[model samples]
Every structure is written in C-alpha cells, then in structure tokens.
Target: MALALALPAWASHPGQRELIAEVVRDTGQDPAALEALLDGAQKQPSILEAMARPAEAKPWSAYRPIFLTPQRIDEGVAFYRTHRALIEDTARRYGVDPAYLVAILGVETHYGRITGRYKVLDALVTLAFYYPPRAAYFRSELKTLLELPPDHLAGPLDALTGSYAGAQGWGQFMPSSIRDYAVDGDGDGRIDLKNSLPDILASVAHYFAGHGWVSGAPVAARAQPAADARAVPVADARPQWPLEQLQAWGYAPLVPLDPALPSSLQTLEGPHGPEYWFTFDNFYVITRYNKSPLYAMAVHQLAQAIAAGVGDAGP
Candidate 1:
C-alpha cells in the first residue's frame, strides 16, 4: 500500500537501487526514485553491527535485570497516571490491556527517555546492506521506509532518530509498521510517535491486536522444572514443549497446559540451582520481537505488577 505514489529524490545506493527497482515493478510508482531511496540505505555500517550484537542470544537471567527494575515499575505507575486517559481509551478501543501498553513503553524507551541514539535511516541501511543474517528482512523494511510519502516527514531525520535497529518511537516500531498502523490519535492530523502519547498508546494497542493478543489470557506461567529434564531442541524450538512430551522426558509443569499448543522449555537460574517454565504460545509471540525469554518474562511480570496496584494508589 505504501508504494502507490512517488517518492522524493534521495541519495540512493547503486546496487540496492537496481534490486529495489525490479522488486517495485508493479507498485505503480517511480522505480528510479524508489531505487534511489533504497540505495541511500545500502551504505550504513553501524546498522548491520547492531543487528548482530552480543545481546541477541544472551540468556534470560542476563536479560531480566536490564529491564524489570523497581525504577521502571515506579516509572510505569507514574506514566500510567499521567497518561491515564489515552492509555485507557486506547485499551477500550483495541481490547489490548492498558498495563501491557504502559509496560511496553517503560521497557522500550523508559517512557521515551532512551529510545536509542542511532539514526534510523543509517541503522536500517546498515543492516540491509551488511547484516547478511537478516539482511533481506531489513532491506524490505528500508523499502517500506522509502515507499511511503515524505511530506514534512519528507526529511529522513523524522524516521532516522531512534534504535540502531531502526525501530522508532516509544514502542520502537519499524518505519514500515509506523506507516501502516500509526493512527492520529490526538487529532493533530499527524501521527508523531516520538512525542504523542495518544499515538504511541494507540500504536501499541494496534500492534498487539495485529499480533493476535488475546486480552485476559495468560502471557506466561511460572513453574519449577524437575531435575531430570535436559533441553534437546526439537521440531518446534520456538514454541514451548508440550506438557505431555515434557512429562515423558521427566519434566512436569506445575499448571495444566493446552495440548494443541507447542512450547519452549527454558531452565532459568533460580536462587538455589535452577527454575523452569514451559513458555506458552503467547510467550513465544512476545519473543518474536526480541527473542529473549527473560525480556518477555520481565514485560509479563511488570504488567502484572502494575495491574496488581503496587503501591499507594498503585505507585
């Protein structure tokens, strides 16, 4: 839908341009201009490196403390109170829970404090150019960025100031997603993800709905695994191991699990030796973004904390 128009002249990447031109053949627009935009994205270096950082495969224990802080929880409550109207209204409209939205904001940008210091264009370009592992995917995102009309957002800077991975705004969405699902929630005729709480809140809700967020359903469960279970990657490595299969392997979930769903078996470092959980389908869905179980648990736990009314007036 984004490539249905002309894009402004841009400093294009030569090789990437040609490839994008072929890809944009039937999109009803100027292929040369689209090529130019993709070309500009092909020359960034840092973006590629960001995609392959050491943090990507870090364990859940290592990832948990990075977020899920007392400070973050306190900040989440304050953010909730300050933007209660937009958060609540967006939740009501989208059927996505409000605490999860608030928790996502808190985890992603600290309610917009540190969304990332990289220029989004440079980041996307770098990844698409040099990050061979996910190069094709990021390259498509760069295409989405160039395919959309610029307007006052015509300057690359509007979409460029964010994560080294090129995710923009409080919820850290890719530029393409921003273009597709972003709503003008504040009636300003523009969806300013960086500064508009309404837009950010609405965007968060929309993303969850797009991802099949089932409101009031459990995101994850906490349980201890038996000593005998050893992780052997199987067919559905991303999903949790089914409780039946896991029990056969001498691992039992403290709670009942849906047999139809696949699961991921994770053993976490508990206070003593280890603790474990069979991550559910929804948990795997959450990890699709970051792929770290700890990050998902932190978000799930933080959301629960907020919903439980943490402190005086839940703050």
Candidate 2:
C-alpha cells in the first residue's frame, strides 16, 4: 500500500482547504498551485492591530492635519507639474478634476513615496480567516485577488505589497476595485498600478467617474448656523435633504448655493469648536471612495489646496 502524503501546513489550517476548493471550482486554477500560494502566505497580526485603530476613527481635528499640510500641498503641485499632460488627458478622458487625481495620490501615498509595506497575500489571508469583524469582505477580496489574471497585478502573487487592508498602488485600491475600475492607461497591455503612473492616475479617475463624480461642482461648503439653530442629527454623509430644508434647520452655506440642490449637514469637532458643513452631491460621491466623512473632507481640502498652488498652470 502506498503511504498517504502529508498535507501542507496551510492545508491543515481551518477552512483553508474549503477556500482552495472553492477557488478551484470557480476559477479552474490548479489546486496544487493554490495550496502552494497559501503555503507562502503568513498570517500577519499587525494587520489586524492596524485595522482596529484606523486613522478614520480619529476626531476631525486630529485627522485634518494628517493629510493636509504645507509640505503635502507643495509636493502635490510638483507632482502635478511633472505629470501635467498625462494627468490632464486622463482627467479629461474620465471627466474628473485633474487636481483631485493628484490629491488622491498625495493623500493615499504621498505621490507614490509610500505605497505600503505589507505583502498583499499575507494581509488578505490574515484578514480573511482571522479577523471576524470583516472576514467575509476580506475573504471575498482574497478570492478576487486569486482570480485576477496575471496582467492585472503588477507582479507575482507572492511578491505584491500593499496597505494593511490589502489596498494596492498609489491610490490604495482594493482587489475588487482593481477588477472594477483599474485601467491600462499606458496601453502597455498590462495594468501595473504600482510602477505605472498612467495606470495609477487613470484608475483613480475611473473610480471617481464610476462613483458619479461631477466635474466643476461644489463638494462642500462651510455653514453658519443660527444662534438658535435647530439641532440636526447627521447619520451618514449621503445627501438626503435639499439645501433649502437644511437652511430651515438653521444650517446655511457661507457661500451662495442653489436651494434646490440635494445636500447633507455634517458637524465636526474642529480645532476651536464645532464646525458645520453643508455637503453636496459631489461630496457624497467622494464618500463612496471611503465611507468616512473625515477622509472625504481631507481629500476635498487637499485637492483645493493643490489646485490653488497649481493655479492657471493646470490643464
């Protein structure tokens, strides 16, 4: 009788074999190869730790300074200058603001200076099997990563690196976002988000366009609440009320805006005191990228700063 072969360490992991079998059935990828790939993926505890304390959890006053700074704005201007033609052309192609494209890159990775430091495989596997809170979501993303064609990824599965949440490239796109929105802007027959600027910029713009980004539209406006302002509870950043209704509730935009426009009122703890903001449809669109209002605000403010710095020079 032939001796039974010993299963790999990863295969012994709970649910590991089931996941591999599902991938094999869905994608027709070789099971042996999938097992080998899983064998190479080491569970990362730090990824879980980072997830529990995300920067988005910070208060608005604390979070505001992380991405918005003089240095980041200056660097964004320089980055835009360096890739003016490609950025402008891509923005035009996708109907997105060029400054926003630059700002996303700046806030996500400091203009590609710091994409991430974790192996993509480890990050996904750890989150998928170990983190119970978002395990299903991570499991789906892990499956997507495994199913991706060779060209969609910048490198081999074992070699790819990204954020703790498994987001890749300068824009910090997850695997599903890569599948849905990533583009080969360079026309090189491959989408390399990490090393290719055309791919990176175009992918970000495509995501915004897919999420209904309105070009040349107001994102947010500071609101002056009446001394006897009616207290309004903001649940999420989605625009659910008309601007006129918000005014009746005592939150009025400091700038002129159409009363018919749909908007949401957001109150944040600012440096000095509570800050009121009337967020618009475009602002709601930005929240689609990251559910946190603070994140959207940071990106909006950063984009405005970069736009001011790049001024008449933008295309």
Instruction: Candidate 2: list runs displaced more than 4 Å.
Output: 1-11, 312-315
> What are the models' TM-scores?
0.79, 0.95
Task: Name the TM-score of candidate 2.
Answer: 0.95
Q: Which digits, one per residue and each the tens of the lDDT, describe model 1 over residues 75-155? A: 888888877877888987987777888888877888899988776767776777667788788878876776655531313
Judging by TM-score against the true structure, name the best candidate: 2
- CA lDDT for candidate 1: 0.68
lDDT of each: 0.68, 0.89
lDDT by residue (tens digit), candidate 2, 1-315? 122234333446777888888999998999999988887788888998999999989899999999998999999989888889999999999998899899888888999989899999999998998899999999999999999999999999999999999999999999999999999999999999999999999999999999998888788999999998999888899888989999998887887899998899988889999999999877887788888999899988999988888784221
Best by lDDT: 2
